[model samples]
Target: MEQQQIKLVVLDMAGTTVADQHEVEACFAKAARMSGLEASDEAILAAQGLSKRYVFQLFWRAQLGESHPDVETQVDKSYAIFKEVLEAHYQTQPVFPTDGCLKLFSYLKQNNIKIALTTGFYRVVTDIILGRLGWLEGLDENRIGNDDSIIQASIASDEVEHGRPAPLMIQKAMRLLGVTDPKHVINAGDTPSDLQSGNAAGVLLNLGVTNGTHTVEQLIGHPHDALIGSIDEIINLIEGIKQGRPSGKTADAYSF
Candidate 1:
């Protein structure tokens, strides 16, 4: 629980460190409509933090019931549309870091903690967003840079065999960062699957931010060490840990 014991912090992209205004969810709905998949927005939003392809697959199965002759085709079409829509949005729209995201990064860097971004997005779109925010500047080919780099590392859902609600992405981030112990990592995200993923990874701390896709009531249904309204509160938790306080260990809710 000590500050020095924390070696890395794994973050979710769209809703955690990036200000997502339901854009991704909206795109998913569009893709579903375009592909003739019957899915409600609530269903798509509930699947947030899950790999987009998997989301489509789930929806296709639900829509078609069991197996259908054209299930794969429909899923593929929806997924393709989703990728195109999301890619174009990030490529054309103005992108900015979430509130206090940069300051949290600075604080982590100053404390010698590694920062890694994990997302349900594919590598292509991930790069586009990172590039727009100028967070991909110093990253190397492996996408795993040092603390001095824009971000220590970035892991996309495609890079891992499984996405959120599974530990693969978090495990991949830890491996790439050269951090061996899950007990020394913290996972902070904005969705239920994010918390489930962190819990499956057995991280030292699993936190949630309510300012993103899900509300506090939704996030509390998942297992998390703490919940906050903004990323800026991370600084306060780290500072508390530095002072020998069991700050983030308590399952309290924080909203600003």
Candidate 2:
């Protein structure tokens, strides 16, 4: 069977392209503790690629039950704390891109493949990280810029009604980039929700990288066309596809 050409690549931020350093998870845990909510580490990890506010809402409901009267207030409080912590950390702490991220981006650009960054972060924080990494060097407020920009577009969770596990963000990226066929795109991230979103979008390739939040063992059970330890391996995956090799709906590939 011939494989469809991949015209675009949608990437998840934080754990995928950017080194997460467990900072997001740590902030979530700290917010839960400060808010007097009980959430296990696994519970937090499971929602890795979800919206921040939505994650807080889920935690609140899980802790106090869905019908709890103070669920809204608790969610608000926890989310606010989380935002403060996260924003402050990103503002002060150093920002670093994941290994092989720059090389992968350059290769995709050279191949004339469009790149879109989709994240669970809000626009403000997303801009902060992008600016710090110089990814936004040539980007303006519109976010759609020339080849000088590292990425062609950016789609944030809050921009869509529903975030990861919903496929809305990926769909939005496709719409903005003028890509009509989902089969012509590749969605890559480091969390289960990322794979779920890509699958829901019916993309040709749904890739998972272990260098982020989840490890190889943690991501094996999720739906994915390939699994690698670094984003750099994507270069070869696309090359294989262009050579008429199967890049999807087969055994997962682990190339670290």
Leading candidate by TM-score: 1
Q: What does candidate 1's lDDT look like per residue over 1-256, in tens digits? A: 4434788889999989999999999888888888888988888889999999999999898888767888888888889999999999999998888998998998898889899999999999999999999899789988988767868999999998888899999999898888998977888999999999999999877898898999988888898888888877777776666666664443344432
Error of 2 at 18 (Å): 0.2
lDDT of 2 by residue, 63-96 (tens): 8899999999998898888888888999999999
In model 1, residue pairs whose N, Cα or C atoms come closer than 3 Å (at least 3 residues apart or on different chains), thus clashing, are: none
RMSD of 1: 1.8
Error of 1 at 215 (Å): 0.6
Worst 10-residue stretch by lDDT in candidate 2? 247-256
